[model samples]
Target: MSQSKPEERLALELSCAICLQLYRDPVALPCGHNYCLGCIQNAASAEDPKSPKRCPECREEYGSLETLPKNFKLSSIVDGFLVATTGGGLRGGPTVPCDQCLDNPLAAVKFCTRCEMSLCPSHLKKHEERHRSLHVLVELPAERDGKRCPVHLKVTEYLCVQERLFLCSDCLMEGSHQHHEVQTFEVAKEEMKRVLEELGKSVSDKLQITEALVKSASEGPTDKAEDKLVARANILQNVQYVFSRFSTEITVSIAV
Candidate 1:
């Protein structure tokens, strides 16, 4: 086998294991590895509903889909690498013309994300004169955080519990969330954990009650409750198994 270059090796590491390709709309797991968002979600949902969501790469368990967060920084890097390496255009193909080169619209060398303009090599050099003023991105497209408050242009930082959606700080004070109940990420996580535990206990308790009721109905002077329970347990075994499995799933999901 041919040895891989350092750049190729790094690309491999960044690529999603599920897709076996460059990360697109990447999401980071608690395990610190990233994968395409759709890929991981599909994988988890494809698993038996009774089982914990396991990381395809590490076998790390997650309690719920809410645990994963998008890796925006890594996504930016992946998009840049893809466009640079694959000659990606505005349409995500080759041969997109540079917007600024009025005399000759050559194939773009870079895309200025802030200005939303493509640039040829000469214009790109001029753009670099104050590169810190704007970001240079690749021509390829990827999912980005568009949930920021349109007016403030900052990320929506709070979940408005009453509205059932996220809101940026500006929106909380001046927009629709002013009178709504809100919660931080930490608070929501704790609340979900409590709810999940309660759900598990409730199901387990109901199952035991059902088991007891079955025994009571069958009990007679000759019938020991213990003996009757043993005889009828197999009849309810499948139902019990389903409940037990569901309880485990609820508990594990909350922990994730």
Candidate 2:
């Protein structure tokens, strides 16, 4: 049998790499490989901290972690294309094929600043082993308490109910939040809803008052018009009475 062309072989390989899989949030690595972001992170964390990560297939080095961009346009295109081609197997959802190659959608294993694409876990691990030491691996929500953490640089999720501020878990446990009531996200959401409702009512009342004032202002010209009509009618009546009396005097004088 004749051997498959290199391009065709590459396409086939790419298809196998992402077979039956759609990328969620896609990321890219510096080596131009893609992977699922979550899968990559877990893999990177699983290995011994001392050893470097290696590529799953070629054992090539891959770089550190990064966030994937939501490719909404590509997502829509892939979703439509899959629906048309797969008949019913690929359900319509928010996912897209890789823009560079159609064989697989970009996997969001980790983000790559250099490649600017989402990578699969395999690609992400390789990147971490190879380039993580040189470049920083930035996590999402990149700040906390106006300070940056060495690892994960993400803003901490802890919130203080008494202070009405977001804090790191460490800060919450510190002396600053001692004896203060701490609440979870659900409680905060409920309080926010209540405040929004009160604000909505106040806005509605103000709108109603504004509408009444506008109506009254619109009627001011009409009131002035009515007053002018009444005054003119009264003046006309007085003039008519004077004319009648003058005619009567003329008639009486002629008769005499």
Candidate 3:
């Protein structure tokens, strides 16, 4: 539980002040603080032009700023942390320590979405008994997103039929896929299942055809190849006998 504090603090720092989301294209300022480049730009733009541009967090002044330095290390670290939390969950080492277990220092198995607290096995059992309709996070919901749209950066709600991918509400409206057919994941599930069933039938038909082909091939003509080889060998033997007789006649005529 003591170690969990640092991880949470790091996550808080990595979040962009403007978007209130994880930093995208993180850039370091002169004030030794990091923010998203777009956030910094917007913040700078909102300020007075006569005075030097000041940082939103620290209020540090910068007279002339052409470019912001990329915080590659911080970005990489944040990305890694997000990856660990979002999908793969904790590995050998535990990040979320149990708040309930004080003396033992046990790792948290599940997180209560309502209480925003981690629980160990024993605590989780108690929590289940006490808290009715409790929602526990087995895995953090894909960075709190099922899957984000590539363009809009919002949670993808629908599957695009023509493109064959997930699309957000914004993407479905204004994007190139507006003309294309789409359906919500709820509806798409049944549609996809129907398509899958059709494909399965097609596959079954093809398999039957292939099986028939294989069976016919096995039964069709086993002796044809052997018969051809035997005929060729017999022709060669007859030709050889004729050649030997011809050679004997030539030898006898030459001797005379």
Candidate 4:
């Protein structure tokens, strides 16, 4: 649970705001929001090129697609993240075998949370037949063994911020988290989305400043070593600010 939680947050960070998938050739907009290159390009193509190009996430306008920077560092990190999460070769995590299988266990297609068992299609149909109204069957591997409150054994729909854990409805009424600050998962996710938007704006501002400085330097004669050093220092400072803010926001987001 400890490891999976962080991986989930990392997955969120790597996902494109448009496609909602791991980035394929990620690029950064002038607004500092990241998206898959093809996704953003297709969006730009769908609109009039002469008109101001606005980011899908932040709606910040930029001039042209030609000026958008490919996020090579983020792309590299995506590669590593995929490898680490998927165990280097496989595109997905290991399949959960059907708990009902007696021999030669088949891969599970769904998980019955109420029964607390993974099921193949045959077993799933039987499960649906007998307990259609009662059972909560979720797609296998996606929800990852189903998110249930350990104490109440109910589907966890709320997050207890004080305890840094998920809570079911009963938890809010009678569990240890009864008096703590809590929010629905949907609300928490929305809050994180706003945090991400603010982080994007902060990055955009810092990068714009750095870009302006670089453009100014490029326009003039930069033959002196001291001038070059100063330019490099300013650029580094801006970059540091961007990443520091990003880290802080992401940490807060994961905690939520």
Candidate 5:
């Protein structure tokens, strides 16, 4: 029994309640329960509207339907762990065990719309039925190679400048040649480099313009200060001239 407990703990630690594989989008319910988004939604929808929506295991009723918020920090940690374990690939579902109990691995997980995590199928179903349109299930496409040419056995070797498509060398010469300008593999690569260089220069020019504008703005205050100083000096000079003229007139009066 002691050994069983440890094994159960390990299993729960690696498994996610919703996806039954691992947690991708983990969410915390108002009842302090954690589940994948899809799993909870499904669980919430399983019962008839006339009945209360409750947790499957605890049977605790949540009277209102509200979409769960995503736990971003937990998701990041889980994603990092999975990536490290799988060599940067999400090959299998989550490896973390459930937090509720150490026994009984999670099973049949689904995606939750509100929570943005995978949920056990039962939980997800319940969420769907109760929340109605609150939760949405998304279908993601599998990763595919976009560079391969389906018609030709060979890899894409040429790009049609006019048609703007990657084509095999044979296809470029035979079928696509009539209307399109064909560029060699090497030439296309060079053109890309040239385009990047031009874009870099354009960005640099814009940055220079921005710098000039900032410099001009900074000079505005200095220009105002210089103008004020010049006006003060002119006023002082006029006062000195008036004093000198008054002294000359007084000296003449005293001599007479």
Candidate 6:
């Protein structure tokens, strides 16, 4: 099979599984899995809090999701990737118009999933007032139709583990998926994002360490054959570590 290009691989590394978009405010769990802070928290909230929390990918059990660490390295990498891909043109890209606007459509600031509409500053203010206590606003392109179950034509919010398919609320209520292991999409995405984030971090760490080691070896004394041999061996070891770490990350990412 053909391998993914460098940019494509990096894009995959930077994306969050929950929203299937670039990560925002990524956080790392104890299991080393990375996820968007809000995504993970929302997934955790759905579970019974009394029980131990499990890592989304590995299913490794851990207590408390109260103090997850922010993955600064991965976040920086994502920012840099965005800059490179956008060619410093992050601002003036094509934009989706406000769905609420009729005559002259304005650039939408946020999308209301509940209302299935994009809102501009003016309309958004009104929406907030009307549904002050209950609203679900998200980034643009929620892909509502894409998220619907093909069989039932309802939103596929649930994942049937046994069948490995996304199911709508109706599927569960109708007993078609009775006794099958299931989880919310939020839960499944959280787990997958966690693993991908951890792998991205691991690869970054290895690259940094390898670069430092190579620099050190280049500057080291090599007057004698013995010293030269040692430096070469050290550089070789660092290169091997970096390659192995990257290989592992690619394998895990592809599997995911």
| Candidate with best lDDT | 4
Model 4: residues with Cα > 4 Å off, grouped in runs: 1-145, 218-224, 251-255
User: Looking at model 6, which ten-residue stretch has the lowest summed lDDT?
Assistant: 86-95
62-139: candidate 4 lDDT, tens digit per residue: 767778888999988976775664443123444555567553343455677788887754455556667765888776
All models, RMSD in angstroms: 21.3, 24.5, 20.0, 26.5, 23.7, 26.3
**Cα lDDT of all candidates, in order?**
0.65, 0.47, 0.62, 0.72, 0.54, 0.68
Residues 67-111 of candidate 3 have per-residue lDDT tens digits of 778899987876676555433223334245455643332345577
Question: What's model 1's lDDT at 101?
Answer: 46
lDDT score for candidate 4 against the true structure: 0.72
Our model 5 lands, by Cα RMSD against the true structure, at 23.7
Clashes of 5: 50
lDDT over C-alpha atoms for residue 34 of model 5: 67
Which candidate number has the best TM-score? Answer: 3
Q: Which runs in model 1 stand beyond 4 Å of their true positions?
A: 1-128, 131-153, 220-256
What are the per-residue Cα lDDT tens digits for candidate 2 across 48-126?
7677665444656665555434445544544444454333212443332222333334323234556544443334444
In model 5, the runs with Cα more than 4 Å from the true position are: 1-11, 63-65, 91-256
TM-score to native of every candidate shown:
0.35, 0.27, 0.42, 0.41, 0.32, 0.35
- Ordered from best to worst lDDT, the candidate numbers read 4, 6, 1, 3, 5, 2
Q: What tens-digit string does per-residue lDDT give for candidate 1 at 99-168?
A: 5744323345567788877665445545666575458566524322234444554455677776557666
lDDT of each residue in 1-256, candidate 5, tens digit only: 1233332343355456555555656776667666776677777787787887786666777655565677777677665554543334333442322112222333323344455443333344445566767677543212121244545433477777776577875686576465778877688777766765665565566556555654554566765876656655665565556556555644533332
Reference-based lDDT, residue 30, model 6: 80
Residue pairs clashing in model 1 are 63-253, 63-256
Cα distance off (Å), candidate 5, residue 8:
10
How high is the lDDT of residue 126 in model 6? 60
- Residue 4's lDDT within candidate 3 is 38
